[model samples]
Each structure stands twice: as C-alpha cells, then as structure tokens.
Target chain A: MLAALPNPQGVSVCPRRARWQLDLLLLALECVDLHASELMLQVLRELQLQGMIPNRVVFWQIRCTNPFRQVTQRTPLPLAETKALTAVVVQVARRQTAILRHLLLVLDQLQAQNLPPETYAPLAAYLDRFRRNFRKRMNLQRSSLFLYKNHQALNELGLKLLAQLLLCAGTKGMERLWFSLFDGEVS
Target chain B: MLLQRQYSLPNCTLRIEGLSGQAGAEQLDIVTCCEWEIIGQNQRIKGGKDFLVALLNSVPAAAQTWLSGVKLRRSPQYPIQVEIAAANQVSLHIPRKLLQTSPEENSESPTNDEAGETLEVHLTWLQLADLVEALDQFCSDSQTLPTLIPTFHSLPRRAIAPAVPLRKQLMPLGIGAASLAAMAAIFFHFPVPERRPPREEALPPTPEAVTPAPAPTTPNPPNP
Candidate 1:
C-alpha cells in the first residue's frame, strides 16, 4: 500500500525512525487485509460462482490485493493466521496508532470483498475482543509470551472450535468438514 | 495524553493514542465470540440484562468482525444510503497539524453506551467472510451462551455447591441457579416476585342506632 514504492523515493531520505513509520503503515495494511470488509463481500459472490470454498461452501471469496485468480488456490484460511500476521506488523506500534493500524487491516480486508450482514457481525466482534484481550498484553506485556502462556492459544483454538461448531449449526446441506474436526476431537 | 475508554457491553478495552509521540507501539486485535445457556427453574434475577449486556460490551475493541456485527445488532437500525455518484467525489488534503491532533470533538473513546462504537464496520471480502463466519457463530452461540455459575467467580464449586448434569443441589446462589440451566430462562418462565405490602385488619361495623330511633317515633305516632 506504501505505493509498493520503487527505490523508496521520499521515504529513504527520512531518518530510520521514518522508515519505522513506513513499516508500521504497511503492517497496518496487512492487518486490514486479513480481516473482513465491504469489498470482500463482492469478492465472495464471485468466488462462489467460480466454485471455491468447497462445493458445499459455494461462494467463499475475498477482495485481496489484485490477485483474485490466485485466491481459489487457498480455501478457508485459518482466522488465526490472519491475526498472527497483524501481530507481526504492529509488534512495536503504540495505542492509538495501533488502533488505526488495526482498522486499516480491517479496511484492507473490506477492500477485498463487498461487506455483507453476516460479514459485519463476526468481523466487528473479533476486533472488539482483540482490544480487550490482546492489545493490552501486547502493550503492557511488551511482547512477552503472556498471550501465548495465559490465554491466546487456548482462547483462539476454542474460538476456532466454536466457529466450527456454529458454521456447522446451519449448513446441514454442506459436506461435514466440521465433523472431521469433531471426529478429530473424538479420536 | 491518551484517551482511555472501558466498555463492559461487548467486553472491550480501548486506548486511543491522543499523544502518539509518547505512547509505544504494541497494539493487539482479537475477534472472538462466546455464548452459553443457563436455565434455572425458579429464582431471583436482578441483573440479567445488565449482566449479559455488560459481557457483550466487555468484548474488546480490537475484535473487528464481531464488533462490526454483534455490536450492530445490539442497537436499533440506522439508515445508510450510499450515493455512488461520480460528481460527489472530492479530493481532500490533510494539513500536517491536522494529522498531529484530531479535533477535540473526535476525542471520546469507545464505551458501552455509545451508539457509534457498534455501528457497521465497512470491510473487505476476506475480512467479511471471517466476520460472517464469526457472526453466524455469534448468533449461533449468543442464542445459547455458556451459563457460568452466576457469579464473578465462574467456577462451580467456588460460586455454588456443584451440581451434576441434573443433580439438584441447594445452589448456594439460591433459586436463580436452582432449577434451570439458563439465568435468562429461569427469569422469564418464573419472574422473581416483588415485595408484598403488609396486611390490614378490619373493624366491626356500627349497629343501626338511627333505625331504632326512627322505628320508636313511628310506633308512638300510631298509638296516639
């Protein structure tokens, strides 16, 4: 998003701190990319028609940076991975800038698709939770293993499991990839 | 100076960097939803709405997906008519000072009671899918959220005398935790009663003294 700048242009002459600023900006971009947005909704309609997101899922597409064709190569990207990516970018970001950075991540994701009702619900919910659970630790804990040690791993996994639980709750017509999750739990 | 806001509604903690130069760069974004049911047969329910609303509001601000939808559903619908006209487009420039500090009016941070915090988040396709998945998940879960032991202390033994799947214990938490699994359920089926007023005593009625006098007067007149 930083223009994918050729030769760094105006950015290079600035001090290393400025370079850090640029880094923060792009990291913010990544955060927006991973989350959901309005544009992503539009992308989903297209993806469903293209036969992505499992024949059962129908249309699971996103509005990512330019490579719409490349998306189908992957299906059902783990929500955690996106979050982790955001974490990396904002490793050194402070509170308010951190907020803008995270919002940008969300905005980027929106750019990838047309936002839908279902999309907004969970997306907003996720961001709200993040501010409570993660931001403080990252800021207060200063990148310690606290998130990992205290709750992140278990919470996220549990949430993922929860997601699987809810996703299967409605889609009786779809094939049971979720059952595999349960089966894995059972076995 | 940084703006600090705490919301118990969606369970969120937000620190808006009013002074970015001083604050550090360690931010976090979390998107999670949890729901369970607590059904009690008979009980006292003082703060079900506040409790659940507090829990929902407690959800952190960085949780973009659920924040966008779950929070949105919590409020009355707002009208949004997007105009796609090309003529309306305008280029705006940001002065250096403007970026340095937002207007004082824009200073307030997100909290539970505010209508703006839960308003719809405009997002992209991937994030939307995540949001949809999260939301479908929230509705599925919120419809039936986990019923903790009905106390700040969530543990069973810690909060109440533990109960088996259907074993009926005295439930130290009282009637609220007694019969049903859901706090909301117990509340609706059999609402907690309000205090009754004290009973009053009735005194005996006075006899018809006036009637006797009138009867005597009529008898005397007839005899005469």
Candidate 2:
C-alpha cells in the first residue's frame, strides 16, 4: 500500500540516472576513439622492422578500437565515408601487423644470440605481462565496441614499457644508425 | 688553416694529417693518420717511407686482415694512410683537398698544414666499417662529386687551433686561482660586523596612547 502511493507525484516515470548512464557510455566511447587514433604502434613497428629497436617490442593491437564504430558514434556519415575509413584502417592495421611479425622474427634471432641476462630478462617479463593483460582486457566483455574503453591506460602502459626497453637495450649508436638509414631510405 | 681530422674510437684516438709542407720533400699526395703521442714511448717515424710502419705493427691480426682489403695506392690521386703508433692506438693520414688532381697539380696547392681542412669523426668499430664502405663508394665514383674544389675554401679558419705559449696558457689560470683564493679569504677572514640588538635610542616611538580611528560616516544613504 505504501509503494502504491508513489504514483500520486508521477515523477518516477522518467529515470534521470539512466540518461546520465548513457552519456557516460558515450563519453567513454569517444575517449577510446580519440586515444586509438593517436596510437603509436604503427610508428613503433616501422622502427622495429628497420632494426632500430634492440629489445623485444610488442603492441597488442595496432588499432585498438573498431574503426567503423568509432566513425559512426556521433556524427551522421555517408555509408561511403564510413566504408572508406574502415578500409584505410584495415589496410594500415594489416601492414603494421606484418611489420610486427617481421620484428618478432628479428627478436627471435636476437634471443638466439644468447644476449646477457641484463638484456634478456626485462624484455621477457615485459612481453609476458603485456600479452597477458592485453588479452584479458580485450576479452573481458563479449561486446566488440565497448572493449576499447580502457585504451588510455593501455597507451600509458605501452609508453612506460618502451622507455624501460630503451633503458635495458643500451642502444645509443644503434638507433642513430637506424635513423640515418631510414632518412636515406625515405629520401 | 690546416684542418686536422681527429677520429675517436672506444679505446684510442685517430689523428689524420695531410702532407704538411714540412712532412715530406714533395707534397706526396698522401694524408697521414697517427695516434696521439704517448708519455714515455718512442716517437714514430716522421718520414714518408715508413709513416705507417708503427701503426701497422700494432693492430690485431684480424684488423690487419681487414686493412688488406683496403687497397693502399702507391701514388693515389689522394690516399689515406692508416697507422697504429702504440697499443690500442690508430693513426690515419688522409690526403685532403686533392679531390682528383694529379700529384703535380696537387703540389700547386699549399701543404696540408696551410690550406687543407680536417674532418674529425668519433665512432665505434661498426661505424668505422660503415664509414670505410661509404668512403670506398665515394672514391669509386669521384666524378659524381659536385663543388669539389670550392668546398674546402668555404671552411672557416676557426677550425684550426691558434698557437698559444705555455706561459700564456698558465697565466690566466694562475690569475683566476689567486682571485678565487683572495675572494675566499675575504669571505672567511674578513671581520663580520656583529649584529647588535636595536638600541632604545634608535627605536621609533610606539603609539601606546593611540586609539582606533572612528568609522567614517557615509554622506550617501545605503541603497535599499
């Protein structure tokens, strides 16, 4: 009988908190989209392929967000524009993945060289942790679109790992060689 | 101005000089690389016949084998001689400014001490290998080099160090140290005036009898 008395005010029909929840979801999606577009994995892959990176470097996914969903989130877009964006993202991702595979091969060779413990241990730990965490996070939700909500933290993780790799590699002159060669190759 | 090319490796330094006016009887179309002089070691040969003998004697057999791959020209239009003068020491004499001129034409230019410019590079063995390869490629295709002649003239004279007397070198340092000591003694030994409490005579009068000023009355009525 007490619950039935609430209908007298009629304020309960529209739940304001539900709208706020939707806004929060959109905000998170937008944040993930912004961060994914700025991901430096492609650039890092290029460096790795060119033999600049001394340590084992890995990126979980080149494009962490679904490109099609990211483009269609807010603004109404022509189907052609969305398709084109998706195509370009897919192409870039494929190339980046290829380069990453090549880099992994090179890393395998470096490991076979039996580099000192000072060099090997940190790289092994980094690869293991990154792979484990990335897999867990990406698989957390069955939904494809919402999986990238945590990408900002993932980007920070990548940058920290890269700095650590550089510290462990002791690759001062080697990077110069790679950069100089890259410049020449580009020119 | 003589441009001296100094290359630094991890363990040693390489100093290369073109044939100075005093280095040879004739401008031999040769540049020389030599290690820095050691404190107690015998001086290396200064003549042309065995300028590299001392350096050649010092390298490991592997490096010597690598050296053999490099062709040493008897009378290269421009030749660089590599030498090791002491343990872990390397010296290179690179004939500069002779781009492709014959010895006769090269002699027309002033000796390496006067007009030649030196290029100094610091690198490891790997970098050195890369440089050697680059140089080899450049030498093989000298005809492609544009502005070969005027490039040397554009180099500034400041690249060469000016001769300084030993007394001149020591004078400024001594003066600086003496000034520093004088400043230190002045700072430490100079009398520090004791900080005394302010005397009552020097104190400003305190307003002991002063009362707080009355709040001013406003002429205009407060806006309601």
Candidate 3:
C-alpha cells in the first residue's frame, strides 16, 4: 500500500518544481487538443473532483503558479489543487493513450527515416502549436525560456514534454506523477 | 451458491467466483475464487479474496516505474504474491495451500510434504493489460465491493530513489570518457587493415565509355 500524502486539505504549499511539471504537462495536453481546458473541466466533473478545482477561473489560478508564465501568480499552489490538476492530467492522458501512442510511433519512424518532423502533418501541427503556445504564454526573459527562443529548440522541448505526458498516462500514472513532483523537494 | 464473473479479452481471461457476503441489497458480492488465464501459454493462477485484493492494490502503482518489478502481497496469512518476473512478463505465485492434490499421487505432482511451494504463472504485458482492464471493470461495478474503489497514493519518500548530487551523477560520465580516451589511444597504436587494389571486374563502367543498351522487342511485336 502507498503512503497517504501529508495534507489532504489545501493547507500545505506544493513544491515549485511540482508546479512547473504540472503546468508543462498541462501545456502538452493543450498541444494535443485545442479544447483541453474544457476537456479538463469535464473530466474534473466526471471524477467528482470539482470541489478542489471548482471552475475554470480557479483552474487558471492554480496553473499560474508556473514561474515561466507571462502572468504568474505569486501565491504558492496548494497541495489539494496540485492533486486535482494531476488527477485531471492523468485522466486526460489516459483517454488520449491511443493518439499519444500513435504520435510517438510516428515520431520514432520519422527519427528513423531522418525525416523532418513537419513531414507528418499531425505531428508537425502539434509541435507548431506547442511552440506558439509556449511563446505566447511564457515570459521569454526568463533564463530557461530565453534558451528556447528558436523554433527548433522549442519544438524539441515540446516533443520531450509530449513523451513525458505519455509516461504519465501509463499504469499508476497518477502516483508516478505525484511522486515525481516531489522528486528533489523531499530530500 | 457461488456466483462467477469473468472478463474476457482476445488473449486473456480473468474469472472471479465468490458468494454474496452479508452485503446489503446494493453491495457487491464477496470474492472467493479468482483465476487468471492467458491463452497459448501455460500460465494460470487460482486464488481467492487475498489475490484479488493484492492485484487491485498493486496494479495502480505497478505501472508507475515503467512496469518495473512489483511484489503484491496482502499479508502472511494470504500466501499468494504477484510480481513482475521479467520485462513484458508478470508472474503470480500461488501458495501450495491453494493447489489441489490429484487422487493418484504422481511424482510430478506437488505432494503435501512439499511445504512452502508455490505455482507460478507468467503472463506477457499484453495479457497483463487485459487483466488490468478487467480489474478496472470489476472495480467500476457498483455492486462490487463499494469500499474497493481504486485510489492513487503518493509513494513514500523512502520508496523513491534519493536524488544524487550533480557531481556523483557526473562521475560515471567522466569515467566513461577517460576509458574511451584510453581505448582510442590503444586503438591508434594498432595497424589498420591493408588496402587492396580494386579489381577491373568490380569497377563500374565509366560514363563516357558506357553505351546505352538497346530496348528489347516483345516476342510478339505489335503490328506497326
């Protein structure tokens, strides 16, 4: 049996790294589907976890904890909100497992053939959207974001993040993601 | 009376037989017999409630580590343990207590004297995926154990590998680079393969010297 998280309520603040990871995963989900926010809300309702996230406004508030965001929130994200977000992300990834697998397979084939990512329409679209989203939402002045100034760099980051999201869809994905959030923060 | 429920897939089948416990009208039946079978393989395990509980508990977390080895055990009293035997394979160890004895004591059969013996069933990942889907279906059934809802819990701190210092993490790379450099130095000292002159037959005809081949005519030429 796994150990319960220390705080069930929204008392304890989530670790900064966890917040960044969650936000990035959410970004990858958005790249996968344009209406990801709506899908997340629907999943939240389906999972009966609305009490923690409440609505879109509250969801946006929690997601703003990502330091790279252009309009970042100063307040630390709450553990409850983190759990809710993680749950939603995992559920979304689970639902998109087939598509995710297909995209990754295509990516592998492309890499094997030494073909550019744009050769495949769907994958090219996903990477292009990811780049645009990152550029629009992120504060480019931030050291990390500044490094991804070029389209190619941003595309590579997007592909890496997409693979990570796929991992989050695997079995025990929820717990795996939860533990990963606290990776270096614990010790 | 025993009630049997099974979830079947193209390659796998999970069957559970149990009696309705003192559960009220809305509650699920108590599981007693559980069997997992993967077709085209000599893999099968028969257990009871303990096995089901262990499976239900472990599965959600089992895939957490890239499907790394996971050992599922409820308690000592429940002598069944399920764990990953190899990459792409899952093994369930059913205790001898759960094993039935044949009327004729064959030498090949496990005898009562053989204590602490277990029958192990190995299943491929595809088979495991089917089993997990079946378990998920079982968990969703409102009539099943109402308290048996699948939930995710964070792994304990100790269970997670502690983050290594940057220096420690880089040490292996440094060692690898130094060894590679040493190997390269040794390789440079060795003699290279002697080059042989290309044979005339092996050489392709020069473009200028090459002549275009004549187009072959059909055996039955079309009337022109």
Q: Which scores higher on TM-score, 1 or 3?
A: 3
| Model 1 interface Cα RMSD in Å | 16.2
Please write out the lDDT profile of model 3 over residues B17-84, one tens digit for every residue.
77677643435477778877665363455666776776676554554432221222222233545554
Best by TM-score: 3
Top candidate when judged by lDDT against the true structure: 3
Candidate 1: RMSD to truth: 28.9
- lDDT rank order: 3, 2, 1
TM-score, cand. 1 vs. native: 0.17
Error of 3 at B166 (Å): 10
Q: Roughly what TM-score does model 2 have, to 2 decimal places?
A: 0.18
Each model's DockQ? 0.03, 0.01, 0.05
**Alpha carbon deviation, residue A9, candidate 2 (Å):** 79
For each prediction, how big is the interface RMSD?
16.2, 18.5, 6.6
Ranking by TM-score: 3, 2, 1
DockQ of candidate 1?
A: 0.03
Instruction: Kindly list the per-residue Cα lDDT of model 2 for residues A80-99, writing each as its tens digit.
Output: 22222222233233333333
Better of 1 and 2 by DockQ: 1
**lDDT of candidate 1 over B85-170, digit per residue (tens):** 11111111112121222234223421222443221122222222232233233333321232322111111112222224223554
